[model samples]
Target: MTVERVEFENTFAVLLEDILAELPTFNIPSEGAAWVKECLEYTVPGGKMNRGLSVVDTLRSLRGEHATITPDELHKARVLGWCVEWLQAFFLVADDIMDNSKTRRGMPCWYRREKVGNIAINDAFILESCIYRLLKKYFRQDDYYVDLLDLFHETTYQTELGQLIDLLTAPEDDIDLNRFSIEKHRWIVTYKTAFYSFYLPVALAMIMNGEKREAAFTQARNILIPLGVYFQVQDDYLDCFGDPEVIGKIGTDIEDNKCSWLIVQALDRASAEQRQVLHAHYGRRSAEDVEKIKQIYCDLDLSAVYHAYEEKSYAELCALIDQADANLVPAGVFTKFVAKVYKRNK
Candidate 1:
């Protein structure tokens, strides 16, 4: 099991390198083109490439190793994997600006670079355009090409909707804790993180498999949407209570005035004094302020509530996924894959 897992992971790493290398060749090979290469490389590489791997792995699990996935089919899947990575880069570049985040994935964000700064927004647009170019270049001849294109468009729109709601609900100019809600948090994550991160890749795989447009969307939503939500909620849970060494980064959702599951849940159950404490200290970055907020959340017993939610969500998702026939797309594939993610603390 470990050997197979290692082989899968290693193959993914090489694929990432090739994707990065391939980006440079697309440029005109000029002076500033070098940094375009660098920007894309750094922004694209740092993400957990689980989304990309899920596409190929899901395809394999569905079609089986013995089935002949043509070299063209494999090429398109790899290219679609790059699209997922590009989508993440688009979000991260913009998100850093909104969160006032100085770093991402343990390095300086695109917006903070010497010649980049606010220009990262333009770079983000470039990253986004590459996705369509690649899709057209590789998958346009396939029967499912139009469906894949439409899925990417709709998925991007939904993510932008989630981001808009999130930004408006928690504006930097206004630090009001009253605006944050459990309902809003879930909605924000569902559209923003869940759709693109969870559903998009699997949807891409299904589209490539020549699944009907409606059916592909249906199957991806039945599992991937919930999987996306579960993934984001686990991220929120991990922020304050997680081991940074294991997660590979420190959590800062509180300090950033961002909407997170923990604060919203705590808000729903906080006493007047506890609410006041949170209202005063919620978005502060200082150790003293963060410590105070942590104390209040601890007093509220929100950790227990979060754990309850996690277990319940896991059970619900498991049931829904089980009801989905493996014959359509292999429920066992995502079930086995997402189970670890759903249960992980880091």
Candidate 2:
């Protein structure tokens, strides 16, 4: 890992450790406490944490008068980090169940743990509830406290709507090429992944920093929301085509029938024969069928097209951010926001 990546990892570890130390003080049974600790330790360690770091980095940038992140500031950053982790945990546990996934973060999915299984539905709920608990403990007295709570809820609702649309629009059993479209892909990513993943952390920081609560949220929605969608689209594009070691997990969107970027792009460009090949091989969990679909994607040469779109999407986001002007909303904050998540490999 590069020096900067290590910096982020260390910062994230500090935040998680503080959270754990305090979590035991809450009144809970031994099993509940053990499950919470296990879920946090296992699930939170796996991702790139661009979102969580964005919170800390943006806060640093927003400090107007030689600002310092004191212990209290560090605690607030850690709390926001906890929120990002909580949001991810909520989605991933449910997603594992929905996808029937076996592993996550190099460990078993929470839903599939030997003691958990189907009871994971409630486990997901508990994970989500922890976000509010952390928020209430850390930022409840701030004037923006209610706004922070509302922001998480609204963003979560948006993501769940996107997830529902994704599941309905692209059912696992049916891999119809017609269902995949750029428009649908945009919707799925914007609502399902970006708002919570990209915008929420920054918005949380902005709110805590005492920026115009309403205006900051509006600005975040306008810019970070689209940026977030762009981030997820790149992930979908990378899944089938990216290197396993570089991207970490092997691509399985086809087998999972995920409405991913490449499949939609292929559907948009496929010839008649290519269409048949997709119908036959798409979403096949079998290794051979997965390879066959990947071959067809290679035949179509989707990466070049995807790269062009990625560049254009990024350019568009930059233009919007430039036009929005950080003076109106702390430009440095969004600059770091984009930097943290511009194009992560894993």
Candidate 3:
């Protein structure tokens, strides 16, 4: 690991302690407190930490690489970064249940663990509430505290709205190719994944740095939204083509009736016979049905299509970053993000 990554991981223990230390104030029984601690530990820290780490990375880029960040500033950045992770954990717990997912981060979904079952739903809520609790404890006195609150709340709402759009667009009971389109796919990813995953961390860093101008945010959004859309499209592609062990989860987008990028692209280019095959087998639970859909994706050359989209997206993002107003936010802030995600495998 890089020195910066080591530093980032070391801080996680301190923050976890800070969070658990406050559980007593909630007047929970000892067992309850322990359970909450376990839930947080299990759900929050195991991922690649890209989204959480981006907050610190953005802060560094905003301040210049050689500039020294105060210890307090570093701690606050870590806290905000974890808040983003917490927000993600909140969404994933509920999402796993909704999607009936089997695994995450190479482990069984929290909701599927013994004794955790449906109760993971409530655990998801607790995960979300912790974001505000951390905000109130650590950032409450900062001048931009309310902006931080507004940012998290608005991002959460956008993600939930995106989830709603996705669920409605691809309801398992209904299989209609007409309902799947590139436009609808874009909307689902833009709201569901882009805001929280791409936009929120940098926005948090900008707010902490006291750069609250509307124009700066607008400029950031234009680039980050598309960056996020590209990330989710990669996710959809990986779900179909990626190695399950490497990705740490079984791909279910096809069988779950998800309105995935591949599906929409296939719908857009499919012949009538191919469309009929998809409509029959797209959401079925049978392995044979899934293979049929995979065969169709192969025949359609989706792998090549995705690669082409990946290239175009990288070029477009680079162009946007080059065109951005550096007086508002440094181009490196955006460039570093693109570098991290472009052509990523997991």
**Maximum-lDDT candidate:** 3
Candidates in order, TM-scores: namely 0.89, 0.89, 0.98
Error of 3 at 296 (Å): 0.2
Q: How far is candidate 1 from the true structure (C-alpha RMSD, Å)?
A: 3.0
Higher-lDDT candidate of 2 and 3: 3
Tens digits of lDDT, candidate 3, 187-272? 99999999999999999999999896999999999999999999999999999999998889999999999999999999888999
If both were scored by TM-score, which would come out higher, candidate 2 or candidate 3? 3
Best by the TM-score measure? 3
Instruction: Show where candidate 1 strays beyond 4 Å.
Output: 1-29
Worst 10 residues of 1 by lDDT: 3-12
Worst 10 residues of 2 by lDDT: 3-12
For candidate 3, the per-residue lDDT at 143 reads 90
Kindly report which residue pairs in candidate 3 clash with one another. Answer: none
Clashes of each: 0, 2, 0
